[model samples]
Target: MTQEILRAEGLRKSFPGVQALDGVDLTLRPGEVHVLLGENGAGKSTLIKMLSGAHHPDEGRVLLDGQPVDIRDARTAQRLGIATIYQEFNLVPQLTVAENLALGRPPRRFGFVDTRAMRRQAAELLARVGVDVDPATPIAGLGIARMQMVEIAKALALNARILIMDEPTAVLTTGEVDRLFAIVRQLRDAGVAVVFITHHLEEIAEIGDRVTVLRDGRSVAEVAADTPQNELIRLMVGRPIDQQFPRRPAEVGEALLTVRGLSRRGAFDDVSFEVRAGEVVGVAGLVGAGRTEVARAVFGADRYDSGQVSVRGETLARADVHAAMRAGLGLVPEDRKGQGLVLGDDVAANLGLVTLRRATRAGFVDLRAQRRAAAKVAEQLAIRMTGLDQEVRTLSGGNQQKVVIGKWLVAEAGVLILDEPTRGIDVGAKVEIYQLINALTDSGRAVLMISSDLPEILGMSDRILVMARGRLVGELPAAQATQDAVMELAVTDVEASRVQ
Candidate 1:
C-alpha cells in the first residue's frame, strides 16, 4: 500500500451567512493524481484555500506524511512542498519571465541581485515543464497557454511534492491541454502527489487516478477516476440532471443586433453577423481566434477599426458603451469577477448596476425600489443568497453570474451577449442558465452566445458561426452541427499543416 502524502480530516470553514465547508476529507498519495470534484460553491475553493494556507480550518486538522501540521500562510505551504496554481495566474505582468519566476526571492550575490543565475534557473524550470518560452519575454506578452506553463514552472520551482491545480485546463486549447497533461504525467511518474480540480468531467477519466466528490461542503464519496460522467455529475450536484444543456430555443423573430464589417485591426477582421430575436447565435472558435474581441467591439467596450454595430436599425456610435447599453445591448463578459460585477458591492447594488441612473428619483437613487427590484430578480433566478444586502463577492460563481444577467433584465435589454455563460458553473447551474436563456428568447430577446465549449455550442445554439484566424470561416445550423463539423471549421491552417 502506498503511503499518503497529505490528508485532511473533518475540515470545516465558515463565512458570515454561509457555511463554506462543513466537513470535508481528502487524501493524496505520492505519485498519484487525486481529483477534487465539486460544483462552483461546493466547498472546493474553501478546502483548497485551507490547504494552501489562505484560510484556517475552523475545525479538524491537515496531516502531511502522517504528521499534523498547521499551515499558517502561503509561505508555510510552499515551505511544506505544497504549491497551488489558481485559475487566475499570480505572475506579475510587467516583469520578464525570469523576473517573475524569481519575483520574491531573487538570487543574491554580495547583496546584489544575480540576474544571470536567475535566468539560468528560470530556463531550467521552464525546460522541466517542457515549455520553450524565452526568459526575456515579459509575462504580459505571453498567451494564456504559455502563461499556464510558466505557472507550472513556477510551482516546480518550489520542488513541489504536492501540486494543487485549480481548473488548469479551463482556458487551454486541446493541444495545450495535451501538453499540460504530459507534464502532469511526468510529475506523477517522478513521485509527486497531484490534486487536480476541474469542472470538465471528460478530463477526469483521462488525467486523474482517484476522485473525491464534494457536495454541499461535504465529501460524499471517493471513487475511481474512470467513474461515469453521469454518476460524477450526480455526486457533485446531489441530484440526477436529466439535461446538461437544456436549451429550448424559442421561435425565431426579426434581427435585433446587426454587425456590418466589424473589424479590429489586429484582433479580428471582416466580421459580420446578425443575432435575431428569440435565437442563440453561438460563436465557436479556438483561443486567440478573436471571438471575444468582436463581442467587446460590438458592445462598445473596445473600438473597431472599421465597422458599425446596429441595434434595431439604429447604428451605435463608435466606442460608446452608454450608447450601446441605451440601445438595448448587454454584454456578459467571460471574466465575470473582473468585468461583470463589482465584487465589493452588495447583490442589490450589482443587480441594479445597469439601471442605477434610471432608478433615481429627484437627485436621489431609490434604495428601497432598487432592493425590491434586486429581490425580484434574485428570486426569479433562484439565487441562493442570504439577502440582497450580502456582498456579491461572497456569493457562489453561478449566483454571481445570475446577478450579472439579472442586471441586464432589470435594464430591459433586447440583445444579451453571453460570453462563456456557463464557463465555471456546475451541471445543475448550467441547466438553470440554459433555461434562463430559453426564457429570455421566449420573451423575444436576442442572444449572441460565444463559447469554446463545443458541445454547449452544438446543444444550445440555433446557429453556429465558426471563426479561425480572426475571420468567420463557416456557419452551421443546429441540424447539421457536430463537434467534428465545428472543429473542422475552427481549426487553424497551422493545425492542418502540422497534421499533414
Candidate 2:
C-alpha cells in the first residue's frame, strides 16, 4: 500500500463575506494522482492556497507524515517539499529557461554564481520532464505546453514531494495534453504525490487515480477515478445535470452577418460563411487553425488583407471596429479577463462600458441610468455577486464571463461573436452560458462562435464550419456533425482541400 504523505483535517478558511473553505478534508498518498474537482466558487482555490502556504486555515490540522506542521510562508512550503504550479505561470518571460529554473537558488562557488553548472542542471531537469527545448531559449518564445513542462521541471528542481497543479491543461492543445499526461504518469511512478485541479471532467479518467469533489466550501464526495462522469457532476453541483447543452430549436432567418473570401495574409485565407439570424454557427478547428483570426476579421478586430464582410446585405468598411459596433455586431473575446473586462472596475461599470454612449447625457455620465442598465443585465444573466459595486476581478470565473456577455446585451447587439465562450469556466456555469445562448438566438439574434471543444461545438451549434491551416474546409449541419467527422476535416489536408 502507498503511504499517505500529506493529510488535511477539518480545514476552514473565511474571507470578508465568504466562507471560502469549511471543514474540507483531503488525503494524498505518494505515487497517486489525486484530482480536486469543483465549480468556480467551490473552495478549491482556497484549499490549495492553504496547502501551498499562501494562506492560513482558520481551523485545521495539516499533517506531513503524521506530524503537524505550520507552513508559514512559500519558502517554508518549499522546504517542506510542497510546490504549487498555478494556472498563471510564475516564470519571468524575459529570462531564459535555465535562468528561470535557477531563479532563486542558483549554483554558487566561492560566493559567485556558477553559470555553467546552473545551465547543466537546468538541462538535466528539462530532460527529466521530457521537454525538448534549448535551455537558453527565452520563456516568452515558448508555447503554453513547453512552458508547463518547464514549470514541472522547476518543481522537480526544488525536490517537491507533493506537486499541486492548478488547471495545467487549460491552454494546451490535444497533442500537448497527451504529452503532459505522459509526464504526470512518469512522476506518479516515481512516487510523487500530484494534486491536480481542473474543470474539465474528462481529465479525471485520463490522469487521476483518486477524486475529491468540493461544493459550496465543503468536501461532498471522495471516490476512485473510475466513477461515472454523471455521478461526479451530480456531486459537484449537488444535483443531476440533465443536459450539458441547453440548445433550443430556432428557425433560421435571412443572413444577418456574411463573409465572402475573407483573407488575412498568413493567418487565414478565403474564409467564406454566413451566420443567419436566430441561429448559432460554430467554427471548429485545431489550435492555430485560424478560427479566431476569421472571427476577428469579421468583427473588425483584426484587419483582413482582402475579402468582404456584410451585415444585412450592407458591406462593412475594412478594419473598422466602430463601424461593426454601429452595425450591431458584438464580440465576446477569447481572453475574457484581459480583453473583455476592466479588472479594476466594478460590475456596473463593466456592464455599462459598451453602452456608455446611450447612458450618457449632456456630455456627462448618468450614474443612475448606468446602474439601472447594469441591474437589468445582471438580473437577466443571473450573475451572483455582493453588489454592483463589487470589483469584477473579485468575482468568480463564471461571473466574470457573464459580465462580458452582459456588456454586449446592454449594447443591444444584433449579431454576437463568441470566441471560446466557456473556456475556463466550470460545467455548471457552462450550462448557464448555453442557456443564455439559447435565449439570445430565440430573440432573433445571430451568433458566430469559435470553439476547440468538440463536444461544445457539436452540442450548441446549428451548423458547424471546420477550418484547417488557413481556410474554411468544410461545413456540416449540427445534426450530422460527429466528433470523428470534425476531427477528420480539422486535421487532414486531403479531405480539407477537397472540401475547400
On TM-score, the leading prediction is 1
**Candidate 1: 10-residue stretch with minimal lDDT:** 490-499
Write candidate 1's Cα lDDT for 210-234 as tens digits: 9999999999999999999999999
lDDT score, candidate 2, position 139:
97
Per-candidate Cα RMSD to the true structure, in Å, reads: 2.5, 2.9
Cα lDDT tens digits, model 2, 405-453, are 9999999999999998987788999999999999999999999988877
RMSD of 1: 2.5
TM-scores for candidates 1 onward, in order: 0.95, 0.91
lDDT on C-alpha atoms for all candidate structures: 0.90, 0.89
Q: Supply the global lDDT for candidate 2.
A: 0.89
